[model samples]
Target: MAAPVPLHPARRAVGEALAPGELNLVGCSGGADSLALAAAASWHHRKESGPHAGTRVGAVVVDHHLHPRSVEISGQAVRQLKGLGLEPVRIVSADVDCDSRQGPEAAARTGRYAAFRKAMSELGAARVLTAHTKDDQAEQVLLGLARGSGTRSLAGIPAARGPYRRPLLELARADTEAICAHHGLTWWEDPANSDPRYLRSRLRTDVMPHLREHLSPTIADSLARTAAIAAEDAAYLESQAKEIFPTLLEDPDASGALRLQLKGLRAQPPAIRRRIVALAAVAAGAPAPSSERLQAVERLASGSRSRGPVQLEGELEVYRGARGTAEYGKLILIPPSSG
Candidate 1:
């Protein structure tokens, strides 16, 4: 109803991350962060007009259909988007089996991304916006470190990947809440966020504070900086891999069995070799092998062969040859069969 305020710093960050006039699809979850992002983007679209001015900016909210009230919450999100002058689009609901080990959180995330991707494809959106913030990045880094993840995992969430972008990654959750308040908007908070039963919730409510008290006061910022540095390093590593991966990648068939010569792989440095193996495993949809397993694979390539096919979680198998030849030390990633 009122003229939108000039772009706040948070909104400016969004505008900078995603240039104005680009066709964007926002993944709005009715949460404070996403609501603020949607409102900011809408304002940006309104104030600027050009060849890209009329550029389409739409909203998609995944119901998740988890809790009984999830549908109602989604409806509220739609109304909020409409209030902010966005055309809201409904997406297909995913039937998530919450009983899985990863639990409802992982299922919802998987389903949410799938739905967003589908909507983006259908709408021909050049890019999609997510509301992952600085706090989330910090949390991710801590979680990854707690799990003893490699530098790749510590890299945290990427700023731009394929059709996805996170404009709010530089801002904290508090800033999002402030932006919503500035716009006279109220948001629904999911109760699950406060439920201590979830590991993340417990970390946020308990572990982080304890760490802040006993450890460095700037732990969050430090972790976030580590993540940023890791991301830059990871990007450079990937770029390097691109130059050699083609030669290193094994021949592929319709069945999607890909094998690379471990001998050739060992010629590269440890970092590059591990990256090649991890990338291959991901392409094969197998759980990425740990650093130890990758080291073992390297040993096999160097002629110290494993007794049998070295299997990694997610179906990636590394075969050791007896002859210590390029053909003998082969790594194959067998793709997951269709369910």
Candidate 2:
């Protein structure tokens, strides 16, 4: 048998992420990061003997149609993926809603992910690998901070969520660019990535560069490290909250309103207490409350001031049981139409 060929570090990383005999799709966008990922995935699947030996790799290109030449760019990516010997290369067009309340970037992302899901379902792929590099993780953390987000938000892009996997999270953007250059691949530069109208674009083009110059040359790495730590903490806290949550719940009333013993809730530390409140709200069919609203719920539970039912999204309400009643000293979450 011929000796196994050595692989590039990026290619090895991609190979390690794949399971043998699985059908995986690379989410390519003709950008340097995604092109490099596509190249690496192709290299991994071509290996005749290894952990990823029987892996079948394909590519999915989502055209958001935000730019005039979006279709042309997607065609280029498809040709490149085919050139790299990737089979089942698919191009999906995303219908981005400009009027979406989440803004253009998020709207486009929602549409893109929907397209990915459709392609995955049609191709019977096990997972879709994206090219969210370390730099992207750092930017996400900064964005979360700017929005005064909680630990979960600051946790940045997860390495894997559901059927989507990001194997390049540890690789720097520069490393992906180098890989593309080594493969003699020409990648597209998306203008929207640098447009000042977007907050992330401002951070990437201005804030990040300024921080790198004055704060630290490795600020991006530092931010990415913070995100990892935050992810760990968030996961641990959520697990603890889930464990303690069921014990605190009281049987639902005749109207299906949920209740929790205030004593059990107060016994928990603030972090765990707030999480339990959020969980209870969600269980009562309400959307997760904002930080300030969560704090308000806390006040309603333990505060001296008189405050009645706290209104939440999804037509749910939370309040402390009134004194002298069977429901006294309990937190009640009233679902819609339950009175």
- Top candidate on TM-score is 2
Q: How much lDDT does each candidate structure score?
A: 0.76, 0.89
> Where does model 1 exceed 4 Å of error?
1-7, 19-22, 46-52, 249-257, 282-296, 305-307, 324-326, 329-339
Per-candidate TM-score against the hidden true structure:
0.86, 0.91
In candidate 2 the C-alpha lDDT for residue 159 amounts to 86
| Tens digits of per-residue lDDT for model 2, 235-332 | 99999999999999988868879999999899999889999999998988888888878888988988546656888888888888888998898899
lDDT, residue 139, model 2 = 97
Itemize residue pairs with steric clashes in candidate 2: none
TM-score, predicted candidate 2 vs. hidden true structure: 0.91
Give lDDT: candidate 1, residue 35. 88
lDDT of 1 by residue, 140-222 (tens): 88888887777878999888888788988877787788788887777888888779987778777887788879998777788
